[model samples]
Target: MVKKLISVGSILIPTVLTILIVNFLFDIVPLNIQGLPLVLPFVICPIGAVLGLIGYKMNRDNLARAGMIFNIVLFLFPIAFNIIGTLSGGV
Candidate 1:
């Protein structure tokens, strides 16, 4: 059970923390980022993509594949967030 917990955490914990950190950084950073401020919110996908690619190269196993796939999904999370927000009456 401990191993399972640790294994699950190895991937999820970093992803969640990285997401929070990225969001905080984005919010505080200036909006004058040469127009990137409009698109930088989509940065999460590349972040997860890179993590997945790294995991694929280093781990070389099912877990690595899982990481890669989840990274892509993670990348989409921002878009999903936007959609959900709009649906829920958020701006």
Candidate 2:
């Protein structure tokens, strides 16, 4: 049961991070909103990565791999955006 919960978290964390990052990128959520976008991607990404690794080690193949991939993309997305934004002169 614990392992199952961890597996679920491995997927959920990155999924949520992706949603948050997208919202941040597009300003879909109003900045007037308080505390919603305060989440730290650095913290969440590592947690997702660790959980995904655990899930994989525990043989939860699909969920684990999906979580790992999502975590990677989530971690990279912001850096990529920053690079693009810089190249585009803060687009």
Candidate 3:
């Protein structure tokens, strides 16, 4: 149960950080001096991915898979958003 909780946390934290980073990047959210959101996802998502992979190897399949998916989406979203914005003249 504890491992499952960690897996869920691994998913949620990075996902939320991704949203915050994107919002900050696009100026949708006001910036503060503490810019952890700017740098945290790069650290957190990779760590989460590693943890998820370890969990998968240990057979905690569902939660681990969810974590991996969330980590992947967190990494990809900003790049995809930027590309779409550029193409659509929204950037």
**Candidate closest to the true structure, highest lDDT:** 2
lDDT of 3 by residue, 11-59 (tens): 7777788678776778786778356665566677888888787777777
lDDT of 1 by residue, 1-91 (tens): 4433333443674476445646554665444334342244366446545655665565465664665566566556556766986999867
Give candidate 3 misplaced runs (Cα > 4 Å). 18-40
**Sequence-dependent TM-score of model 2:** 0.80
lDDT of 3: 0.75
State how far residue 57 of model 1 sits from its true place (Å): 6.0
**Residue-by-residue lDDT tens digits, candidate 2, 15-63:** 7776776666688875664434434566788889889899889976888
Whole-model Cα lDDT of every candidate shown, in order: 0.54, 0.76, 0.75
Estimate the overall C-alpha local distance difference test score of candidate 1. 0.54
Query: Using alpha carbons, what is the TM-score of model 1?
Result: 0.46
> Considering TM-score, which of the candidate structures 1 and 3 is the better prediction for this target?
3
Rank list by TM-score = 2, 3, 1
Residue 83 displacement in candidate 1 (angstroms) = 1.1
